[model samples]
Target: MDFENFLKKLKEKDRVTLSKVITLVDNETKEGVEFLKKFYKERKDSFRIGITGPPGVGKSTLLNKLIERFAKKYDSVSVVAVDPSSPFTGGAILGDRLRMENIYKFDNVYMRSVASRGSLGGLSSSTENILQVLEIFGTDVIFVETVGVGQSELDVMEITDLVIVTLVPESGDSIQAMKAGIMEIGDIFVINKSDREDAYRVSEYVKSILQMKYQDKELTPPVINVSAKNDTNIDELVSRIENLKEIFIQKGIIERKREIRRKKEVREILRDMFIKSIDRELKIIENKNDKDVSPYEISEKILKNIDFKSLEDIWKER
Candidate 1:
């Protein structure tokens, strides 16, 4: 189908077409690029939330409960649950949907599982673009759940309005969390499996760290305890999330954050183009008798071939 018709179907909430569009964009096809260029401008509003943490932290269960709360309050909600890529197939197990099976019956709730695809920070290469596609699909709120790959989970902060870092009592000491970079990314910290013996200790440890980190700031991040299995403290979590949204708006940080993310996206695209161009140049050198030349000399040749002036112009134009 034509891009225009596909967009129309997207607005009409056709699941099949939406799935196709997501797949096309995930592959970064020409059609997908065109589709994003045409429709992304119209998507000016949507709240994005990122949920990330270590493996076996009950992130999925917590998200499912949160989605239930969000569904009732928002017009439409969608999820992008990222999974680890299989070494053999380079595809995700896509098991998050199974965890959230109960919410499948809700028409307003759209869920998709994405493979990490070797991208660091537990996100897929296409995740940023897919957010634009979801915006075009008339989703009010979107949730991005990372693959829970330790320090790599920080990338979710680039795309989300609020970042929730879920942890269990067994996740370890506060110093370890800080070292893992989870301490820096969490806008809100959730201690799941609160019934465990060490849950309070973990929460206390995090609270002390937050106090030390944000002592000079007016807004300090909150750490809450919850048991997703028992449906406990979920309402409080929902309230905290809503409150943080208001706080962000009042602080006027949301627009500034978006601007920064846009610049990062532009740089990422340029970096990709540069890498591809260099790879093509390298292939020619590899086919020739260039082994006599130093690696530095070959790199110099690649740099000389690049149109730096054109690159500057492209950067300036956009």
Candidate 2:
């Protein structure tokens, strides 16, 4: 089907078209860029949740349980699972779905695995764009699972309304989560694999850290213990998520968060366009006759000759 038909079917909740649209956006072809340039009305109230943490913390399993719980309350749910990319080929194994096989059986749940593609923030380059499409497609609740790259995955914050950072008992993740950047971003912390002996200890550790970090603040993130495999406390986790949504609404923080996200998206789009425009100059500098040119010097030269309007025009054309 053509782009228009695909978009029409996507709005009609056609799963096949939704999957194709994600792929088209990922491809970043001229057609895909054109489609992205088309504006779609935003759904202001849809819940966007982010789940992130270290690998082996059972983020996928936790998400599966969350999907089951969310499905009971919402008619449609979508997931963007960001998996690590292959360093050699820049391709993704897309293995998050392997553990979430049962979730695929739910017609209301639409899951897409995205390769991180060397993005520093643990999300794919096209994640925000794909999320815009999903929002326009009328998904009631959207969940984003990051590449599990630890603290630096804050890019998830740009798109998700609530960020849930998952940690396991034995992985030293509890302490790691308390480190500078990571602890502050979490709206909720989940100690998964709660069946483990040290689960409560980890939960307490997280809670204490939060208490210390936010003692002066009005809103402190809640810590919950749950076993994704055993389905323990999953309902409580979902309840916390729902409650947080209300808090965000009552405090009018949602609008501020959306504003921040809009600014971030605009900055990213401009950065990408600038980098694309500089590609030829960068290549020329790389093949320069003077091998002694420093990286900083080449960068300075590129910026000295960069044309802002030309780059803007190129971006517009794309």
Question: What is the per-residue lDDT of model 1 for residues 1-318, given as tens digits with 9 covering 90 to 100?
Answer: 488899889889898998999998898877887899788786847899999887788889998998888888888999998887876777556788767854685779998888878675468778998889999998999999985566456689988888999988887554474544778888999999999898889898888888888864647889999999999999999999999999898888888889999999989887876765566567778898867889998888778787776655544443
TM-score of each: 0.92, 0.90
lDDT measured at residue 60 in model 2 versus the true structure, 0 to 100: 91
lDDT of candidate model 1 versus the reference = 0.83
Best by lDDT: 1
lDDT of 2 by residue, 253-272 (tens): 88899989889888988789
Model 2: per-residue Cα lDDT at residue 291: 72
- State in Å the error of residue 70, model 2: 0.8
lDDT for position 185 in model 2: 84
TM-score, model 2 to reference: 0.90
Please give the RMSD of candidate 1 to the true structure.
Answer: 3.2
**Model-by-model lDDT, in order?**
0.83, 0.80
Q: After superposition, how far is residue 23 of candidate 2 from its true place, in Å?
A: 1.1
